[model samples]
Every structure is written in C-alpha cells, then in structure tokens.
Target: MQKNSFLTLSVAVLLVFSLQVSAQDAQPEAGVTPSSPFHIFDRFGDWARLNLLTFNQVRKAEIKAEIAEERLAELKAVVLEGASEDVVNQAESLSTAVAEEVETDVSRLDEEGRNIADLTDKFNQLSLRHQAVIEEILEKAPAESREALTKALEVSKRGLEKAGEVVLKQVEKGNLEKERAEKIAERTIEQLKKQVENRSEALKKITEELGEAPPELQERFNAKLQLLEKELVNVESNEQFKDLRERIREDLKATVEDAREFRKMHNVEDEDSDDILESISEDGAKVVERVEKILSKAKEKVAELERSVAQAQTNGKEIPARVSSLLDAAQKHLTEAVAAFEAKNFGRAYGQATSALQNAKNGNKFFEDEDSDEERDENVLEKIEEANKKIAEAERKVEEFKSKGGEVPAEALRVIEEAKKQVVLAKEALAKSDFALALRHAEFAKKVVEKIGALLERARKAVNSGTSNTLRVETKTEVKNEEVERPANTASSAARQPQVRQVKITAEGFLPRELEVKKGDTVVWTNATAKPSWPASAMLPTHDVYPEKGGCIASAFDACKGLAEGESFKVQFNPIGAWKYHD
Candidate 1:
C-alpha cells in the first residue's frame, strides 16, 4: 500500500514540474525554454517526491548547483585564456567554492532522508575530470608561466584531497561503508600516479634531447637534467614504491637513455673509413711504427720484471698475485701483436702492440724495488700540506660549477672522492711514522685533485661558450699546461692560471720519462695500458723502505685498483725538489 502511494506521489510531482517548464518555455518574457530548464528534475524528481516535505529545499539546492556550475565554467575559461595573475587566482577561488558548494549540497540532500549517494558520486567524477583538463593545460604551459601553472596544479590537488575527505566523512556518517570509501580513495591515488608518470616521461625526454644541446644552452639544459635526476632519485629511494617498479619502468628507461646518449656523444667512437685509430692519430703508418717500438721496449722491460719476480720468490717476499696475472696478459698480447705483424695486418698489430706495452709496464711497477729503505723523509709534512691546499682549490671549483648549473660528470665526482680517501690513507701512514708512504699518498691525492679541478674548469668554460668535442683519451705524449703571465695584483689571476699539464704512460714508461713544472702547477698521467697498472713511488716488492732518507716510504701513492687502459691520473707539484718517478 505504501509503495503504491509513493508511485502515485512521484507521478503527480513529475506532471506538475513538466507543466510548469512548458508554461515557462511558451512565454518569451519568462526567458525559460523547455530545452533550457534544469535537467536535474529528469534524474532526481522521483527521489525528491518520495519525501515531498523537503521538496522546496531540494529545488533550491538544484538551482544553487546550476548557478555554481555556470560560474565555474566562466572562471575556467578565463584561466584557459591565459589571464593575469589576479584573474587566475579569482578563477581558482571560484572553482574551489563551486566544488565545495556542490559537495555540501549533496551532503545536505543525503541528510534530508533523500537517496542521492549516486548523484554525489557523479558530481565528484565531473570535478575530477575538470581538474584533469586544468592539469593538461599546465603541462603545455611555457616556462615563463610555470609559476602560475604550478599554483593551479597545487590548487587542484588540494581540491581533490578535500573531495576524498568528504567521501571518508560520508563513510563515518553511515552513507558509505569503509570499503566503498577506500575504493574511491584508491581511484584518486591512481589518477595522481598517472599524472606523476606523465611528468617523469616529459623530464626524461628533455634530458635526452639535452645530449646534443649547443654550448650556450648547457646551463639551462643541465638545470633541467639536475632537477629530473634529483626527483627520479627520490622516487627510486622511496621504500613505499619498491614494489611499483613496473609502473616506473618508463621513467627508468628515460634515465638510461639519457646516460646512453651522453656516453654516445662523448666517449663512444664512430668507425672511420680507415680503421686504425683514424680519429685518435694523424698518420696510420706513424702510429704503427710507434707501436712496434713500444712492443720492443716492452720485451726488455718484461725480462727485467721476470728476473725481479724470481728474486722475490727466492727471497720469500710477499708478492701480490696480480703481478703474475698482469705478466701473463702482457706476454700474451705481445705474442698476438707479433703474429699480426707477421700477417701484414699493421693496424691490428699496432693496436695489439700498444695494449701489450701498457700491460708490460704495469706489471713492472710491482718489481721496481725489492726492498724498502728505512729512511725518514723530512718533507712529508710539507707535501701533505701542499696536497690539502690543491684539493681545497679543486673542491671550490666544483662547487662553482654546480652553482652555475653545470652537469657535473660522475667520473669527476668519483675522482674527488678517491682523492679524499687517499688523504685519509696518508694521515694513517703519517700516524704510523711511515713518512715515505705518507708523502707518496699525499702526492697521489694532490694529483687526483688537480685532475678534478681541471675537469670542472673545462665545464665552467663550456658555460661561457667553450666546446668539448674531443674525447679525453690517454695519449703517449707530454702536453705542458699552458701558462700565461699576468700582473701580480690582478683580481682574476686564478682564473687565468695555466691549463693542466698531461703525461701519458704506455709499456715503455711515462712519456718524456721526466716532468718539470713550477710549484702549484698540475700534471696528469694517463695510462694507455691494456692491463691494470698501479702507480706508486719508486718503492715496491719490500716497500717498507726508501732509497734516500729524504723520501718517505709511508708516502707511497698507487691507484688502489690499477688504472685500466685509457684511464688517467693527475698530480700537482708544489715541492721545490728533483722528484724522480718511474713506471
């Protein structure tokens, strides 16, 4: 009986509403048309009539919602039209108010014993979609408009959060269960994730394109790259997102592609018409002849190293197994080079010979000194101080590079860290009263710092329109750092300091075999070895002592991991003395 009464009430209310709408549409002064009337009645008329006592309240709510929505649309258009800050802020405020009003009305309708939960959900969906459109616009906005666009995005995010809260409150009020509320919240989270993914893709693409950027654009390019890397690193390090790796695959791929492009542009060589190091050397024939000479020198050096190895064995010295392995590799490559030469493949022979020579020289460093001299070097403290100063200068330059928004190379950072480690080791040696080892470590650290400084200087130059087109390959030639004289009181004298000097190492030994430099000048040693090579002071086998009392055995320097082929180390000289070093 009650159900029949409810159906009759619903029918009567709909008939009356339809009559009123038609009467208004027929009168031109009423400014109401049948098609222009509130469509709210089409969906909610039955529900409103079920409880007719609140009919007036429902009608007012509907009218208010219609006004709010219209206002919202107008404001949205103003923002989309690229309005001024004041207008944009007004639009955002209006949108927020309208969203809040619609939500409040839905809650009121539910409170009035009306069944309108589904209506509330529909409105929320529309609100979310509106925000999506705003977000899309922000993504395409120009850099100059980023601040405004970002502000708009934040507003939308906050609005969505408010909507989620409303849903949760409804759950508390028994209008929704906890499970349903959770599902709605999950929907919002998914939307947020998609937005973040889109942003990540855009950033990665920017970083990739930055690979071929001109020098003038490097600062801006690096700024974007730095921002992307920092954000991606944060995402990667988040424990909560660990399981979402698959979702972040696109972001990760972007990072990888950026790195690959950088290496491709900087390190990886393209094949030339003539295969024998055409990009590295001028004349193929000259390169081949040089390699042949290097191979012959390696043969003699290896013989000397073998004899030392035998003596060390006889004397029961503690020999690192690495020495023997390097020897074997050296001999193998030399044999290969000989075979290539015999077959008239000069290019192949040259490459093989170069590799063999590097290996042989590296193997020889271990056997340089069979016993350490018990000498106390008085200059250890001086060398340590000099090294610290150089490292400080290098660190300052690195900071400057970062401040200018330069893309600091990972290798450059690694080199600085290595220098710091060497400093620690040097201090430990000093504490042990091993002056020779201390001095050597201090020297190595200084060299590494000089290299880092040189690299950062080059980066700074790039920001000022310098180009870095050539690969930093290890060469078997000594290039002195270019020094220019300036007035002693010039404020920018440091900026005009000489470029870093370079020293190349192969199987024969350090190219030039001797280096001369003024105090504070730096020299870089590049290893073109096929095998790993450790560079230390002229003390090995029994490195407990030095040949001269002035040399500290505790100050020894060696790259903990012997340098690989094409790798390099740099050192700054500050001591005024004749320092003798060998391979």
Candidate 2:
C-alpha cells in the first residue's frame, strides 16, 4: 500500500510540471486576432520567451523581430476584419513596441562589444518587409485607423534607420565589409524609391478626384505631385547610393507630413470652427508654459553671466565693452519678458525670453578665448571627456531616484535625452577636428547635465514633501570663437572669407526651402514661428547626412537642441556636397 501511494504522488507531480510547461509555451493557433480570447495566452508566451533569452542579446533581438512580425500580422488581420478603432490602435501600438524592442536589443548587443552585423542585417530585411506591409495596410485601413498605421509605418522606418546605423558603425569598426554595406544602402534606397512612387501615385489619384475642386486647391495638389515626381527621378538617377538613400528618406518624410497637413486642412467643415478655436486655445496655453520655462532658463543664464563678469573684474581682467553691453541687453530683455509674462502676453514674453537667452549666449561667447588648432583640439577633447563624466553622474542620479521610488517627470526625461544628443554631437565634431564646434557641443551637454541634476533634486524634494508638482527649469548657453581659423578649407581665397546667410523658420517651414552656397559659408536659421524648432542635417533624428561624419547621431550639422522662438542656430556648410537639412 505504501509503494502504491508513493508512485501515485510522483505521477501527480510529473503531471503538474507538464501542465506548467504547456501554459508557458501557449501560443495562439492560426488565424487568431488580438481580440480573440486566446490572445492573452499568446502574449504571455511571447513575454516568457523574451525573458528567457534576456541573457542572449543577439537571439533576443531576433526573437523581438519575430514578435514584431507577429504583431504586424495581427494588425493586418484585425484591420481586414473591421476591428474597432481601439483594438486596431492596440495592435498598432504593440507592433511599434515590439519593433522598438528589437532596436533596443540590437543596441544592447552593440554596447556589449558583440558582433552585430548578422543581426542588424536580419533586422534591416525585417524592417523593409514591415514597411511594405504597413503601406499596404494604410490603403485599406479606415480613416481612424490610418493615423495609427501611419505612426507604425514611421516606427518601421526608424527600425530601418537603427539597423543602418549599426551597419555603418560596424563598417567603421572594420567588422563589416564595404560591399555588404553598399548592398544594404542600395536595398534601403530601393525601398524608399518605391515609397516615393506610391506616394506620387496616390497624390495623382487624389488630384483626379478633385475634378470640380477650387482652382487654387487643384493647383496646389498638382504642384506637390510634380515635385514628388521630380524627386523620384532624382532618386533613380543618383549614382551615389548613400546620398540617394538620404534624399529618398527625406522625400518620404516630407510626403508623410504633407499628407497629414492636407488631410487636416480639408477634413474639417464649417461646423468645426469652434473645435479649432478650442484647439488653438489649448495650444496657446502650452506655448505659455514653454515660454515660462524659457524665461526661467534665461534668468538663470543672465545671473550666471553676471557672476562671471564680477569674477573677471575681481581677477583684474578687463571685461570687454561689448560683453558688458550684451549682458545689459540680456538683463533688459529678461525684465521685459517677465513683465510680459505677468501681463499674460505670452507671445511677447516668448520673444523677449528668447532674445534674452541669445544675448546671454553672446555674452558667454566673449569669455571663450581664441585658440590655435592644437590648443583647440586639446581643450575640446578635455571638455568632451568632462561632459561624458557629468552625463554618467546624471544617469546614476536618475537611477538612484528611481530606486527610491521617485517618479521622474517626462520633461526631465526629455532633458536627459537632449543631453545625450549633445554629447554625441560633441563627439562627432571632435572626430572631424572641428574643435570649436566640438567644444560648444560639449559645453551645451555639460549645461544640460547640470540642468538634469537640478531637476532631479527638485523631483526628490517633491517626493519628500509628498507633492506631485515640481518646477520646470531649463538652461542653454552657446560657445563661439569670435575669430578662429577655419579647419582645412579647400575653397578659394575669396570664398574662404565665410559669408553669413539667413534662413527664417516660419510656420510654413524654412522660408527659402532650399539654398545654394559656397563652402565656408555659414547659414543662420532664426525661429520666426511661435514654437521651438530644431534644425539638423537630414535622415531625420540622426542628422548624419553630411559626408563629413561626426556630429551628434550622424553628422556635425545638428543644432543639438531646439531653438526657442526669436532665437537662432547657425551651421557652416563644409566639404562641398549638396546637403539637405530640416527642422
């Protein structure tokens, strides 16, 4: 009797273990939608599988790509079956999340000093497939679902970018062959060409449908379609595959933005004017908040300048007359901004605040001494190192705060992200021996780190006080050499005397939209719109389109951060290629 009882217990234990394994491995059978009852089990399986491979980044990334593909399939299935808007959105969001996960995993592999070429190549192919699928779905999706699908499409494009970035990094490290890289670039360009073609065709169809529409509207549509066709021709004929890829990427981005704008412009009816007004009011409130934040930052900078001036005097160093004048102008603007803000004139306040910040930056620039190439290089290197240290410290503080149960504000997170971008720009600038620009980027990054420190402290205080509110603060300072020798200029002597050109960032976009300038020419973009704008080299967020590689993310042509209203950012075009930029 005892032997029989023991055997029974063992069998029961084996049965329970098998049940647990089956549950953990549960996956939806064929034709299951995200809305189905068994979908939760499918999600659990994905999560379990992902967690199981956490230690294997390459494999994890592969799994993530697969999961993303699955999500995309679910999205297509649900859309075809007329899922509810919420359900569709959920599926799209899941697809985005999984694609982003793949990106993150690949990044981790790169960071771990592992070989990422194969994984990146795999991801690149996956992204292309995803993009094609999303585009097809976009056509069949309902209007409500179109927006979410568009977002998913953008995310897939970013995945492609991420994969390309890895491939480029590996090539630079000599881990990837040039032939392979070129092939990848060619593939991406081909995909982009297809996208441009599709967009042009859609626009043409829309133009046809506007048979009896207003002449002005018809004219605009025709003009846009013609421009797209022209770009398509350029993409196909360009022999330089890399440049072709970038141009086509920009084409797709512009097409997407224009499509959204066109929809917004024509979708509304006379009855929606009230809703539009409400939206305008809400936007105005956000602008007010942004202006207030700028004002606070300007105030801090002006005060720091004041302290620096005092220190200069105490050290028996004569303060430059121009520096004093700029400081006074900054203070004057700050006072006016405060007054305007108090009077609820947010627009005026924003202008004044931006002017104050610019003046403060100008004053700070006076303190930076001119240096020879060697000195500049050394100084920039040191500064970049210092910036990295500060970033490390800030990251530690953030982790500690989180460990202590602190809820980091979204604004603080954004600041951290900006700080990282600045550091990257600094490093890129350093790589090209653009020491002044490098130092400027590094200094900006340092300032951002300081701002993060202050924000985290404020957050900590709020946590301790059992309050959820924290004051928002940000500061910006620019470093410029009043007179410095150009680095390795190959332009003619006459062209070596750099000329400054102006581009206005208006509500409609860059005023001139395009410009042709000789080498050693500087273009300054002033923000004329109410909102802040960031101007950078194209290929979007990475900004590494210039042949000269080294600027945050991709090239040294980035503004690093947003320029507030009434402020300006300047970049000197170098190396004589047809460069593209966007805000």
Candidate 3:
C-alpha cells in the first residue's frame, strides 16, 4: 500500500514539476534562467525549517519549494545553453537538492517551511558518515599516499564547507555581492572536484590491478557514486550550481576516457563488460591523438635544440644534452620511419631522416656518447704514446737549442714544461698500473711537437702586436718570518735572501712526509721512514743526503718503504732549499 501510494504521489509531483519547468523554460522572468552550466543549490530553507511545523507552516513551505523548483527548471535551460565547467558542477548541486526535497516532502509536505530542521540534520549525518568512511581509509593508507590523502581530504572538507556557506550567504547577500559570493562557491566546488578526482584515480589504479571487477560490483559502485554525487550537489550553494554542473560533466567525460584506457591495456582476454571495452576503445583513440600532438611539439623542441648546438659550436662553446631530446625525437620519428622503410616507400632515404636530424642536434651537444668512457680511455692511451715520442723529440731539440749557442729555444722550454707534467702523470698512473692511462699521458707529451708551432705563432703575434720577445721578471721586497742564517755561497746580498714556499708534497711512500716553510734558503731533514732494523736517523745521520744518495731509489719512493704506511709525519723546511735528503 505504502509503495503504491508513494509511486502515485511521485508521478503526480514529477508531472506537476515537469509542467512548471516547461512553463519557466518558455519564460525567463518567472525564475533564474541558468546562463551558466551545472547549478544545484543547497537551500537555506533547511536551516530555517528546523523548527516544528504546524499544518499551515507545512503548506507554505511546499509552495516555496515548488517555486524554487520552478526557478531551477528555468535555470536548467539557461545552463544547457553553454554551461562552462564551473556552471556544470553547480547545476548538479541544485538538481540533487531538488531530488532531496521530493524525497522528504513525500513523507510529509512542508509548504509552510516550518519543520525542515530534522530532515536537514538527517542528511547532514549521512554526509558526515561518508566523510568518516573516507577518514578511516586515509588512516590505513601507506606512508607514501598518506600525505596526499591528508591534503586532499582537508581540501575536500573545505570545499563542502564553502558550498554550505555560499548557500547561507545567498539569502543575505545583495545583488552586487551575489556575483562575488557565487564566484567563491564556484571555486569551492572545483576544489571538491579535484579531491574526488584524485581519489577516483587512485581507486582506478587499484581496480585495474585486480583485473576485471564483477559486473554486479561495478554497477553497485556506480550507483553508490551517483548517490554520493547527488548529495554533494544538493549540499552546495544554489549560486554555485551552474559552475558545479559544468565541472562535474567534464570530470565525468575525462574519467570515462581514462578508465577505458585502463581497461584496454589491462583487460583479460574474454573479459566481462563488452560495453565498457567498446567505450574504452572509442575514447582511447581520441586520447592517443592528443598524445601525438604532444609528441609533435616535442619534435619541434628537438629541432630548436639542434639549431642551438650548431650556434654554440660556431662560437666554440660546449654542446648540451639535448641528447635526451634528440633520442626521443628519433624514437618518435622512427615509428613512421620504420613503417615507411618497411613498405619500401623510398622517400630519398638511406637511414631515417630523423636520425640525421638527431645527429645534427647531437653534433654540438657534447655528451657521453654511449661508449664515451671507452673513447676517453683510448684518448688517454694515445696521449701517453704521444708523450713518449715527444720526449725523444725534445731531447733532440734540446741539442738543437744548445747548438744555437746559448739561446735555449722558448719552444724547447714550453715543451719541457708540458713534458714534465706528462711525465709526472705517467709516473702516477704507472704506479697504479693504469697502463692505458699512462700511455695516454705519454702520448700527450709527444704533442710537444705542437709547441714548436705555438712558438712561431707567438713570435708572429708579438711582431703584430709590436711587443717585445722577452718579458721582464720583477723582484718585489720580501719579508722573512723565520730565523735565517745566510751563507757565503751567494756573493751578492740579493742572492742570499730566503724565499718562503707553501708546498704540498705527496711522497706517499717517501720520507719527510710533509713540509712547512718560511722565508729562508736552507733546509735539513732527519731520517723518518723505511726499515725498522736500521737506525733510520743513524743511516743518514748528518742529513747531507742528495736526491741521488740512494741510487734512483730516491725517486722510486714506493719501492723503498722509504715512506711508511699509515704513519703521518710533517717537517718545517723554513729557509727553503732544494732540500733533497734521503734515508
């Protein structure tokens, strides 16, 4: 009996409401014609209707609800015209409220608006219950997702609260402020949307992994979602309805497309939901087209990167890692390139044009090409070999310089300096058995041949710039902090002056581990490392040892244990001298 009565009344109410709406759509002045999309308003009447309602109060409220419903119908037409995202969200809200009103009024009509408070409380409790469920889920979330969930939950609550506020404010807000308040409501609705979308996205990911959800389960879930969304719109302010509806529609469309993609990729063969898969296939093509557009833009960026590389080289600058960009473009172009090649569509092609484009971009963009380390090793080996060749060449040049009768060629000096550096590095690398590296260092030394060319170039530059071949080395006043005892080895007062040096000596396995110095020209050392059986100090008692004191062993610090392992020692070589001492 109750079901039959309820059905009959529902049909009558829906009919009455439908006719009223049709009348309003035909006439704009009767109610607000929605200019914006998606407007479902949370009514202020519920707050006012909390009081117990007499029969007369009930009748008055019913009249008021019908009037509001009429206005809504008019607004529906307005919103459907071209409702923006903001408007769609708001319209849905108003629709939800309308639904709620019908549901409640069926139980007991309230045209007089006397007793809506209890009903409002009931719906509010439902909303709170839903929030509690969300909060519980958040509490159990893993650490990685907890932060995002917390932020989203807080924002969503705010959005709901703002929707409520906009509804309350509409009653009191003047015409001028109505526009401003509606804007606030629209933004609030958008925030709610973002929160829901993120939640749905995460849920979709989980569901995808689980394989096909049962048809019954999907339908149930969808039904519950629709209910929840309807409630959400009803709770939001009426002024925000248009914007709310628009946002919801757009979210729904995008969400469907996204879900379809997930289904296409992860669906089991012979999966359930033929309808779902069909929808996915259709929407996925559109999404792919959109992605292709992005790829096109990326290709252009790669081209521009190439141009930048060429420009940089013209100015002698290093290349950039548009390396990644070039690689991406090559991959993208290869899609079509391979197809074309496979079909023998010889479009003036040897390799894909994209490869050349990529190569062009790569030309100036200096990067570790795939085997860069191997190449570097090869370079090192080459440099070492060159250094050895140059050493022999320089020895011959040294004779040539001397044969020029006391004019040591500057070219010879420069080559000597370079060869000195190469020799030091080679010794270090050799100690490490980095033969490949050692060889490279040796090769660099041979490049000393180039220094002869640099010398003539410099001479030419000096002639061009009208500068002198020799530059002056000026002597400045020097201060001495350490005590200095001058010797008569220097006849001149100037030659006897001490020179201070801050030198970092790395004789890792050698004696006299480190040295500190001040202005002076002499040094002495006490034997510190090597054999424990020998009295170290006694072996070289007076410290008159020269670098050659121990047979080339002086230079071969690693072989002598002349330096001890894990023993740190330092010395003060103030009044600096060649100071060559050995133990």
Candidate 4:
C-alpha cells in the first residue's frame, strides 16, 4: 500500500506540470491578438529580423531567421489553442493578403537592387572613359582651367565617398522595409546619374571658361577651389581611422573614372536645347507658385492687422486716423496685387504684395509704439489748446479781410463753419477721454482753420485788383496712385455739388484764359485743336503760370499728355486757389 501511494503522487505531480505548461503556451504574447484579422508583432525588432534576413546575405541572417521562426511558432500555437472558428477563417484571408504584399515588396526590392547595381557598373565604365579623357586633355588644357577642373574632380570624389558610407550604414541597420529599400535604391541611382552628368558638364565647362579668363572669373574660381579643397581635407581626416578605408579604395576607382570623364567632354558642346527649355518652363511655374504663396502670406498679415484693430475697438480704444489710413492703403495694394496677378503681370503683382505686407507691418508697429492711454490723453489736451489758438488766429485773419472790404469767398465761410463743428466734436471727444478720436477731430479742425486762413489771404490779394472769379483750389486729401477706371459720371457728380463750378479749354488756349471755378469743381479741358495739345502746369521761365501749387506731370496737374483733337483731360478742383492753366 505504501508503494502504490508513492507512484500515484508522482503521477499527479507530472499531470499538474503538463497542465501548467499547456496554460502558459495558450496565452498570447503582448501585442498578439488571436481573434484579429491583422497581426501586429510584439516587437519591431522581431519584425525587422524576419523581413531583413530574407534579403541580407550576412551570417547574422541565419541566426535572426531562426529567432523569427520560433516566435512565429509560438504565435501559431496560441492562435490554434484559443482562436474561434470565425477568427481562424478571417485570419486566413488576411494572412493571404499580407503574404501577397510581402511577396510583391520583395520582388520590387530585388528588381530595384539589380537596376541600381547595373547603373553603378555603367557609371564605373563611364568613369574609366572619363579618366582616360582627363589624362589626355589636362596636358593641353589652358592653365586658367586646370585649377577649376582639378577642384571639380576632388569634389566629385568626396561626394561619392560620402554617399557610399551612407549606403553601407543602411545595409548594416537592416531594418528598412522592402518598399522603403526599393525607393532608396531608385533614389541612389538617380543621384549617381546626376552626379555623373554634373562631372561631365564640369569637364566641358573648362574649355568654355578658358575662352573667357576675366579677372572676376579667375577670382571666383580660386575662391570656390579653396572651399572645395578645405572640405575634401576635412572629410579625409574625419574618416581616416574608420573601417571605410577599403570602401574608399573602391570609391576612388569610380572617382578617378569620373575625373577622367570630366576632362574628356572638354570640347564637346551641348547638342540640344530640349532640357534647357524644360528647365525654364519648370522654373517659371515655380516662380508663379512662389508669388502665389507670397500673396497668401500678405493677405494673412492684413487679416491679422484687421483683427488687431477689432480687438482695440472691443477695448474701446479708437484707431488713430493715420493708422486707419495706412491700413486702407495696405488693403488697396493687396487688391491691386491680386488684379495684377490675374492679368499675369507677376512683377508688378509681387511688388504690390510686398508693399501691402510692409504697410500692414508698419501699422502693427505704430500700434505697439503708441503711448499709453493716459499719456495720449494728455497729448490730446495739448493738441486741443494749440488747435483752439490757431482757430482764434484764423478768425482774426478773416475779420481783417472783412475790414479791408474784400469779398470773402463763400467757400471760405463754409470752411470756417466746418472748422467750428470739428472743434465742437473734438471737445466732446476730449470730455469722454477718447484720446485718438479727440486728436483726429482736433487735427482736422486745425487743418480747416489753416485752409480758411489761406482763403482769407487769397481774398486779400484779390482786393489788389486781382481777378475775383471763384477760387478753385486742389488740395491733396489722399495720395491716389492705383490704376482704376474712373466713374463715367464724375463730371456730372462734380456738377451736382453746389460749391463746385466748371471751366473749359476750347480750340483757343483756355476758353476764358483766366476763368476760375469754385473749389471741388471739375475743370474739363478738351483738345479742340487740330494738332495734339499738351495742357501742363507752367514752369516759371517757360510757361509762366500753373493751375495749382503742387501741379506737375506726376500729380496729373494740367495732365494732358498731348491729347488728340476731341480728347479731353479733366482736373478736379480740390485745392483753394485763383489759378491758371494753358495749352
């Protein structure tokens, strides 16, 4: 009975150990899902080993393959032990797809690798041809070209060495996917081809460069050579003790070949311009793309400015008049840029867009540089005092004109009344401590007073037996430089204003040579002469008279660039003046 109990206990222990082993085997690894259609391996290292071993020829491939097979075996055991029938069916189809993808990627990588190897061989052959050519031509090449040619050869050699090192590192890492490896191979081949082509061109350039040995060209070549030599030395020193010596040996063979090819094509000129035309077309598209990007950036800046202005508004801070005007100008320029771009005038479009960007930047800078609200309020107070003083002085001048029994122009009285109204508005804004508004109103009031004082002086001059016709003054309210179509009814609109009047230029010089119109009226000058007529501001010694103070061809003051018979040039009488213009 004692012997039987010992055997039964031993059997029980063995059965428990087996059950524990089965339970552990049934459990899935971390990241392993028994029911899922797709598999995500527990570790990238395992996945990489499995994929890399198939393509790599190193001894490590055998070891990594064994480890990957064991891991897959464990995964299969777990799936078979725990996965339901439905999961097994789904995984079957998914596994097939994944297998097909792997096969395709592997095939693609093999094909690309073959292509790369072939190109590398071809390049090597070309390099040998070039080496022979370089040796043959170097003795005959001009002294001026030797330095440049030698430097180009060194640069090409160093670039090849560096590229080879990079390729070796990739091979050792062994983690790149099949697709990725294929792409890399293609890219390497492309780079090699371009490098070879460049070397050929460099060699050809020696001949051309020798034909024109200007001092500047020699200087530039010497500078570039120095830089290349320095870089080559640096590369040689850094890679000296590394295992890359053997690799460099192999690379030098190719380099020498490349150097030879460079000298071979010394006299061969380009035979076709297809590549040149293609390059130009590509460059043009790139330029247009860059311009469009600039336009987009400029627009964003303007929008940012607008947002800043809106924020200031929310805080009950008024935008300064000048700031507002600048913002308007920025917007105007941006619109013009868009129009110019649409018309395919990229040069003008870029200029206008850049201007808009700068203007918006300036506006933001102005806002940031502004004084604090309290300081601004104090400044506004001082401005009000100055404006009031100027208004008083202007009123005194007006009274003096009346005492002299001079005819006070109706426009003068109207401006004085407007000045008073602006002053009232300024005082109201000052009471509310709205400094920006107060300053704007106060400055405008001061401008009106100054304008009225000038009118009063002109009236005084009229009293000295000068013409008393209505004074037509053209003042610079805004700088208008944008090219836009004018409203067709501009003359009719000017006529509708009560304070505006008209003047005409007929077949004879000026209809009433010295006739005047009210301020803000339209002066329509028709070229009624049979010959082309130029109505321009008079330069003192030559023409002797001008319609306005700032009148010049640029300002469109008497601007008729020889209008043909029946053509007309219209000038808006904005400035207050007793002025004259002639053909």
Can you tell me which runs of candidate 3 are displaced by over 4 Å?
1-298, 301-360, 364-398, 404-494, 498-547, 550-583
Candidate 2: lDDT over CA atoms? Answer: 0.61
lDDT: which candidate is best?
Answer: 2
Clashing pairs in 2: 425-552, 428-550, 544-554, 544-555, 551-555, 551-556
Total backbone collisions for each predicted model: 19, 6, 83, 11
lDDT of 4 by residue, 312-391 (tens): 99999877776687689899979988986785545345546656876687677646646875687788878878888887
TM-score of 2: 0.35
- Rank the candidate models, highest TM-score first: 2, 1, 4, 3
Models ranked on lDDT: 2, 1, 4, 3
Compared with the true structure, what per-residue lDDT tens digits does model 2 show for residues 1-583? 9999996775555444323543432222124567787676667666766674256767777667666767877887787566788888888888888888888888888877777787788788778767766766665566577757767765775576567557756766777776676677657655655654554455454333322222222333332322222223222322323454454555444543444344344432211222222222333233344556678888988998898899889988766576788899899989987986785544345556666876787677656555554686688888988988988888888888789666665446656665676677677666655455567678877776676667778766644433333121111111245444243322323344657889999865687765756545788999997777887664542343344554454555766667899998887755323455666
The deviation in Å at residue 264 for candidate 1 is 24
In order of appearance, the predictions have TM-scores of 0.26, 0.35, 0.19, 0.25
Most TM-score-accurate candidate: 2
lDDT of 1 by residue, 1-583 (tens): 9999997886677656633543331111111111223433432542443345235665545443443444444444454444555655554555456556666766677666654444444454545554554555543333344455445544444344345434534655677655555445445444544544444444454334332222212322332222222223222332323344345445454553453353244333212212222211233234345445555766777677778778888998755566687678777867876876665444344445545665566667655543342333346667778888887887787888778556565446756775676677677666654454567678877766667756666655543332221222111111136354332223433354645778778754577655545435667778886766656554342233322232333343344445789887665554323344544
Worst 10 residues of 3 by lDDT: 470-479
lDDT of 1 at 431: 63
In candidate 1, stretches whose alpha carbon ends up further than 4 angstroms from where it belongs are 1-90, 103-116, 139-155, 169-183, 206-583
lDDT of 3: 0.39
Report per-prediction Cα RMSD to one decimal.
31.3, 30.3, 33.3, 34.0
